[model samples]
Target: MSNPNSLVEGWARRYGRLEARPSNVNPLDEFSGLSRRLRGLRLKEWIGFTLLHPDWYSSLIIQDAHYLASSEIYAYDRAAAALHQHAVTMRSGSMPMPSALFGHRYTAHRGDYSIEYEFDDTDGRHVLAIDIAETATAPAISGELHLDAAHAGRPLSVSSRLPGRRSRMYTHKAIFPAGGVLRVGDREIVYRPERDLAILDEHRSLLPYRTTWLWGTFAMRAEGGVVGANFVDRPEITGEAEESCVWTPTACEPLDDVVFEPAEPADPDAPWRMHSADGRLEVEFTPEGRKEVKRQLGLFAIDYFQMFGTYRGVVRGAEGSYEVQGVHGVCESMRARL
Candidate 1:
């Protein structure tokens, strides 16, 4: 492992840069059929205290999922899992988070469900749309939104008061749409990732950093099948560096040696549906949509701090077929000059 912290930082800087991509530059993604490698890259082990509420399984909220984990990529996993725990553990608090306050929110509604997609108004500070997916009850709601990250860390700012919202906030919070189905085995629990998040930074040319870390949920089914599904990243593969991670949980262990190759969006006017390939595990993912979280780098655009989407891919195996679903991610912004 090269473990080049400086190199990784340099690429991070490039990812934020805005420039026209060189004609000869090719992305080494799953669709590209290029194998990515990782030696020593950026910070690896993410240490954080995490939490999850048991009611998450019964909730119809997208944030209320069966698994809660704290990952190192950017500590988003920890933030998410901790919020869940807070929602369940301390339903009412002086200062509270939404997920914690509504650990069992899914139990409140019931109905048949559907998926909706729409883009809200855009601002230089805030750029993104929301993907709303609903399901039958014990109902639950899953809405994916790319809120403003441009000013996420900015100093105190007045937020637009969302209309028709009555929940009081000791502290302000951002939430996507709510309502979806709660599965029978949905358990609200937080954990350290079962598998160490993999980094392809050192080995993969597709990645920009001297190294990058991939974090995701890796699990197995009751039928003795393995399941490894999590988003991966190849920051700085192209100027607007791309990031992606895919898995099959039905296996004994998370699939390894995955790749990302992309094709222009269906309409050639839509987002690209990149293929996440892992031949050794016979798993691949076709992205369904993209959610832009952040777009920066002066007007030319150098950095992209964003998220995208993925769909369950049909895994071809010697014995039979397997279904992988609920995939999402982002590499929003071209010539990411970060």
Candidate 2:
């Protein structure tokens, strides 16, 4: 078999810009046609969320992995400079795919810990309800969050084929108005709809044995309107299907190649600088706190970093320019071999 990375690079060199499918298309139907080039090759899926508020940045990650299933909940309090995290993993675990892309429920459970990400539509607007339960650990953390799609723009959806094989990857990202209350031990943090927002990430990819990627996303309120973006720097795997874009209240604008520069690459909480080749995106990130994970199970290993930060810069697009001022967000870098 050919190396998936090499095939993706060559494909990108030959065909510059990859086209994305319409958001209404079903990803599972697209996956059904692929011929598994190698047995035991993994098809991974996950539902990730980030809710940003003035005083707290909270996130929930649920992975429907084949090698190892896991769920993680994390929050950073800016005022007290405190971090709370809870996670659980099970080897050789798996989850069923959602019945449909738009209105479906996805879940992950292990022992006394469980997570659910349910999606539905209410009067033409998208609604997502997230619930987490962790009854096994001390100071156990749990919560329910409600998010509604408030932007008028279409979501950024990419369903691209890999080179030299039938493998593929599908990604969907969007920003929404969020509100909720999280119970952390004896304390509670509330997210107000007026000031808080959430970013939703849904991914399904049939990947090779080794892969790595750098990704950053943030959403903020600007004078123009609500602004959000998703940036990824991993051409070897994704090629021109970068899924990088600047989202506005009116539309989603595809972005050219982007670059991520960290003041201290080794530091999980280091400040970051990001820019696009087209000179449309220029931003600086100052992190308030971060969560790091290092895990190894048999032949699988991963090193992940998720940082909570505030963004200060400008995002120029076809509609207009958005001035980002102290907007709470998140950025992540990860490498894994499974």
Which candidate ranks first by TM-score, i.e. highest? Answer: 2
lDDT for position 49 in model 2: 83
Best by lDDT: 2
lDDT of 2 by residue, 212-298 (tens): 777888888655557878887764444445578898877778787889999997775678999999877898999888888887867
TM-score of 1: 0.28
Which sections of candidate 1 miss by over 4 Å? 1-226, 231-257, 265-278, 281-289, 294-302, 305-310, 315-321, 325-338
Which 10 consecutive positions of candidate 2 have the poorest summed lDDT? 1-10
lDDT of 1 at 6: 24
Give the clash total for candidate 2: 0
Residue 338 of model 1, lDDT score = 16
> How do the residues 1-338 of candidate 1 rate in per-residue lDDT, one tens digit apiece?
12122222322212221121111111111121222222111111111111111122111111211112111111122223311111111111211112211111112111222222221323222211112222231222232222222212111101111112210001111212122222221322231122111111111122222223332222222133233333343322222222222223222222333444444533423333323445433333332222222334253222322222333454444455556554232233333321
* Poorest stretch of ten by lDDT in candidate 1: 153-162
- After best superposition, candidate 1 residue 224: deviation in angstroms? 5.2
Q: Cα miss at 71, model 2 (Å)?
A: 1.2
